[model samples]
Target: MVRIKFFLFSILFLCSSEILAQTENIKGKIIASGDLVGIHIINKTAGKFTITNDFGEFEIPAKLNDTILVSGVEYVPKEIIVDDISMQAKQLVINLEVNLNVLDEVVVGKILTGDLMTDIENSEAKREMNFYDLGIPGYTGPRKTQSERRLYEAQSGGGLVPLNPLINWITGRTKRLKEQIEREEIGIAINEAKAKYAKVIFEDEPFSETLQNEYFYFCGDDPSFKTLSDVGNELVMLQFLKEKLEAFKIHLEKK
Candidate 1:
């Protein structure tokens, strides 16, 4: 029984050593501009994978002459072959290149209905005449002459108290307050639009939390975003988002 146990121990030791000899711990650093976090380091031969940390450093199991693939969202994929020198050094450094994907040029043409000024004049002719556009028979227009206004105010007892200026002040303040409220409501609507568009863009992708946040901000920073949000038409906003998404995809592919 003692002899059998010794033989088994020897076989186990040999197997462990063989396994260790076949696999190498490859430490690597990814060098690039911007954040290098979450870059994937894969050893296809060994079927092992790892990712870069915040510092752009990673470690993976590889074997001599094994092919290792390094890739990131904003970079071109790179391949490295492990060799004796790398194994001796126990470390490697990879520099990734920006993969710029160019999109096809688009040509847009204007649709003309008629001469712009003529069309405006014709449309104006069709519009109903308001009090200001067409003066009343007895009154001059929406704004009466100063003398006429004062005479009317005097007859109504409004001129005695001089409440016209005070009423004007109150009306101006009310107008300003309404405008402020409208601006705040528009701001809230814009934020909601950004969130909704972000969900639509990345709904199908499996992204890390950090990446999701980054992408959400990226969508918000799109040039057309503010304009589309201000327009406030869902169909138009959706179309604009789709176009922006295509551009963003190309940016990511090329970066």
Candidate 2:
């Protein structure tokens, strides 16, 4: 009889304790700009793991003292503890840092088969040889009025235009053009090169500078290292550019 009573008391105590434990829902947003993003979430007590959605939002059921960790590609991982004792639920906004050192490096171009021009013509799986050079923003074409026409001719051969002068005209800017070829052919070379080394490094100021360089490239202007030697003050039309970079990163990763 004593054993049965003790067992019943023990069960009742456990059930009551469980009911008394604090439980709360955690909600948060993860905003990752400027790079391909991957995320992982961990529940401290449960030792279970999950990931953020495409928009980088996460929700998990947690106890008052439980910890939640968030991580993404090219963005720093963050750990947050649940403290909803006084509050019912919690909301958090996480901003990840960018990785700059890796961004500064130049990755070599992927090789191609056809003749130099033919190779350039059929480079990307999407066959976006010309599209890649389209200026950034709403502008998606050649810097020169004749650039598009020449590209068309090169592709069709029927509009056979002289190649020597065209090559000469675009020569000094080979590095910039090459970067486009890689983007069109495979994807953003930089993102692919450092898939695992994902972290944001540049602060606001430096980030602005880097973006300005991207803008220059977007418009088909090769703002070489020398050209940017003393350049200051970066102008970024953030509204569209932000979306463009994120979309572009995902596109490359998919390829």
Candidate 3:
């Protein structure tokens, strides 16, 4: 029995070590002007991802031949294939090209007058043709909020182009947008938990408003809080909060 246990431990250790050795973090920077923060960096081959900091720097694990794709809202998507040299150096510097909107020559039309009344009377203000005009069915889902829309814009769009990038990158706008959305979710979860468990949980250990706020913030700080809150299951959230309460009580006792 002892021999079997030892052998099993050895196997586990070897597997752990192998996983640890499989990848090393490759630091990289996104070279661009404007908001470089929150650019998405994905390792296509390794299935890893990270975001650029305010300085347009990011790190993601990769080995040789692993593809890194970088995308931005106003930049063209570029792919980097990890080479032996880059792997050895464990760093990358990437340049980005702006995807500028090149407008076609505008057709000469009636110029607008300075007077609003004159412009309204003489000029046409017809709306542009849209999907509805073409009789095409469009998205009927709920409209996305500002943060959601910004997140979508950051992660998507570079127009039709070659996307052989070993990895895909997103603009920095995504990072900030996600945080905003996350805060909203956490706020909702905290409010719901407070309403549901208020007196019941604290009856055994009464806490002042300050302590209560701290306790809830403590719960919010847990990484798993976002997952639980997103799930939005009453029973699951309740159990998770109860577990957090015990942990919080223990933490307070230590202090």
Distance from true position, residue 32, model 1, in Å? 0.8
TM of each candidate vs. truth? 0.34, 0.30, 0.38
Tell me each candidate's RMSD, in Å, in order. Answer: 28.1, 22.9, 26.4
Ranking by TM-score: 3, 1, 2
Candidate 2 residue runs with Cα over 4 Å from true position: 1-20, 35-38, 85-87, 101-255
Model 2 over residues 1-255: C-alpha lDDT tens digits? Answer: 999999999999998666445455667677667443336555545343344666777666556656565544455555676665422536667676654444554546643221222222222212112223555445433354344344444434223686654664467444454444534433232332123112211112233555544433442222331222112111112112333455545654676
Prediction 1 global C-alpha lDDT:
0.60
lDDT tens per residue, model 3, 155-189: 66554762322122333455667889888778877
Which model scores highest in TM-score?
3
| Candidate 3 accuracy as lDDT | 0.67
Estimate candidate 1's RMSD in Å.
Answer: 28.1
The best candidate by lDDT is 3
Q: What's the lDDT for residue 108 in model 2?
A: 67
TM match of model 1 to true structure: 0.34
| lDDT per residue (tens digit) for residues 139-211 in model 1 | 4323554444544443342446767556645567435544554455455555676555455445556757675
lDDT, residue 70, model 3: 71
